[model samples]
Target: MTSGGRRAVTVLSGFLGSGKTTLLRRYLAGHGAGVAVIINEFGAIGVDHHLVRMVEEQSVLLQGGCVCCTRREDLVRTLRDLLDQENSGKLPPISQVVIETSGIADPVPVLFTLGTDPVLQHQFAPAAVVVTLDALNAAAQIERQPEVRKQIIAADWVVVTKTDLAPFEAVSRCRMRVRQLNPTARITVSRLGDGSDALAPTRGAVRGLPPEAPAAPHSEVQSTALGFNAPLDWPAFGVWLGMLLQARGPDVLRIKGLLDIGDAGPVVMNVAQHVVHPPEHLAAWPADADGSYLVFITRGIDPARIADSLETFQRAGGRADLSVRELA
Candidate 1:
């Protein structure tokens, strides 16, 4: 959020019921700097954004799945607006941008955006994706959800939360599981510790900072485009998607992908718990590709495990087959 200099975008993502909102509220209040937040919620209702008790006009609320593939344009637009405000002296000198992606969000694409988008690249820097892992339910969720895997794969920092609710042994196990999925991310364990605990009060003027790295090509990061590849059968995909949902919705961080509704092209994949949205055929595949594919960003979940469960999805369909993977 360094004015004039490029900025940084930090993402906070985790599984459902992991107490992410509570931690985020604490961070915002105690951060003591000009920070804007981007909230990505699962439902059209937009409950999470309202739940965050902050008063910032520049904040953007995106009601959908992971912001990476689902509403990337929204991110680009929001950054531009924030930059404009900062330039005009209408807003405080900003320091950082933190995003609270949907519980099922895979932070990769959103993080990838900083390195990819042309305009955004000039004005912003890519901070590490900070993820929270629920100590209580992480094990089961990892076993069942592909979204969980994506969350972990994309994380540069993994925070283990809700240790107070878990037994001592449970906390230890949670840490072990987090390591299996991400060997490189820096991990911070917080049971009752919230954002307020992390940030100390500060009184000072913030200076603008330039981006850490040069903007790379956007296509290199966003090569994985699923739903645009081919037409997907609504009923068939539904059945397969449902089975995965039933087996792992609790583990789901946030589900966003492309689907084939019918003759209409953009049968979208927008998921939030038990309620999965039917396909809303858009004009065409977002970038005009003919084959439709599915990609997932998960935490503590394995792509192979997810694929094996949803295999009942081929058109000929003796027994369907499907798989979910984490994008680098």
Candidate 2:
């Protein structure tokens, strides 16, 4: 664990043949000092763990199930065991734990297990969800596989892999699709797992929001960017968001924004489905940030409706002059 006594966990997820292993192996090559890995495979035998073991000795394998489903308890147990071993001096002190999930897994359940488990919550803190997308097959896979879309929507950073083999147009299309699915996720390109830096722990880095992409005709997921012309009332916004998430949690895939609440800096908000990360208060706004804005990734929800709802809620909260406009 770090000096704070909590081990930072990064969930690595991607569809089959998306080069998840390559990225993990590359990352461990340089930063495997105090890292432990938990590899979950869908079948009876686990093979990825052995490959990763070449670089890092502290590795555990969970076989026969997906971490998101049947292996959730297994994951919790593995984590608890790691902690126990560290405490008892059976294993070295682990500062970071990397959970490389099966290709078909949905990462949301893994996060839920970590956040809700009474014992694990205090020992582990989520660092990031890094996903890999194959440039050659991303568009087709995203269109055909629901899991791929879910993984993309849930990612904190997405790496488009196999760019060297795929044509330039295919890579561009894949990036566009990812942007449409998760506007706030940082997207990077990689050839032979060169984009391993995306796995590095973020330290309140200011990520400039990507320009909104046109909605894909074949995909149900869409992103909406909303800008507030004035500072917001924090308490009122909380109430509005709480009610909204309670009512339509599943439909809301991701919510990320920087809110100006009449403070010297902005409040950073990140939400993944029902999981609401604690809002971070920055000392000052980034130089590039012009004003408060929010990006919402939703399915089967109208962007205009969301804008109207927020405007109504803010108006009711005494911000009659505050205008909520959909950013172009």
Candidate 3:
């Protein structure tokens, strides 16, 4: 539980055959105590919940629909009921909640539901989004499926599973593809569902950008890394981001960075589609980060246009000399 007494919620998402259940089952093996799980399956019958039930007894199943669309209200009511049970001694106290989404589901709507709900917003706080990527089929799946790309983009930590079955080169390429789609996610390799470390509650920090990789074949998703030479006006940047998301939320897939808002330390920013999480202010900057930098994962948008708009916004905020450069 967080200091605010809210239970931490982790959203597990992946495409079909991405090893989501395998990784989740492994995670629940050792951390089942004080943890509750909600499994969402698209079909009329739920099978994943049964697999998870082997390790955890406090599990709920939502069937016949995807959590992102038809099952959102069900998700709300289930969470409330869990709270009621814990309060009344019907179930053990839950410190963490894991929501495993179906293969075709988009995670942004789940996050939106949690943030916007009246009772849920106060009782639950987002911990992290862990996504599973199949090492052998990720390249083809990412190229053909928009759902796979969205899952990767919304992930905070992406676990590349089935590494033992895939060749070394295939795993390398899979990691590169995930980096292309979501530059901020921490990528790790796992064999036989041993990537439980990915579920650790720590957020993946901005460890400077990796070497640039060629654009994925037949994909419009591109990541642009921008560095600001000077501190930005936080209010002005907020306005610009708000208007940008309002206009092009779908095109702008993800935005994550550490910003120097003329404070003693940097302010951390994370966004998925149109949902902007509350900015975290640190007492000091991390040793690795030299200055403020933002990586934007976008589709069908020119990187130059984004840089120009940010520069224009900063200038209007009285920082005319604040130069924004695209990192190589």
Q: Residue 189, candidate 2: how far off, in angstroms?
A: 0.7
Off by over 4 Å in 2: 1-5, 42-71, 204-211, 215-219
Model 2, global lDDT: 0.79
**Candidate 3 residues 1-328, lDDT tens each?**
8547889888889998788877777777777778787877533433333223212112222354233322367678788888998899988788888888888888877787788788998999887888999999998999889899889989989999999999999999998888878878888999988988676555553454432534562267878888888999998998999999878876888898888999998888888887887777877888877788888889999888999999999999889899898977
**How far out, in Å, is residue 245 in model 2?**
1.5
lDDT of 1 by residue, 1-328 (tens): 4324656566778888776666776676566367777776643333233223222222233455433333356577777777788789977776677777777765555644455567887777554467778888988887788787667655556778888888999888777666555433456678575633322212110101111111231111111222222344566666777777667654554344545544645554434333343334555555533444455434455555655444436444442223333323
lDDT of each: 0.55, 0.79, 0.79
What ranges in model 3 sit over 4 Å off? 42-71, 205-218
What is the lDDT, from 0 to 100, of the residue 248 in candidate 1?
A: 64
Ranking under TM-score, best-scoring first? 3, 2, 1
Candidate 1's C-alpha runs over 4 A off are: 1-4, 42-71, 195-328
Candidate 1 lDDT: 0.55
TM for candidate 1 is 0.52
Q: RMSD per prediction, one decimal?
A: 15.1, 5.1, 4.9
Model 2, poorest ten-residue lDDT window? 50-59
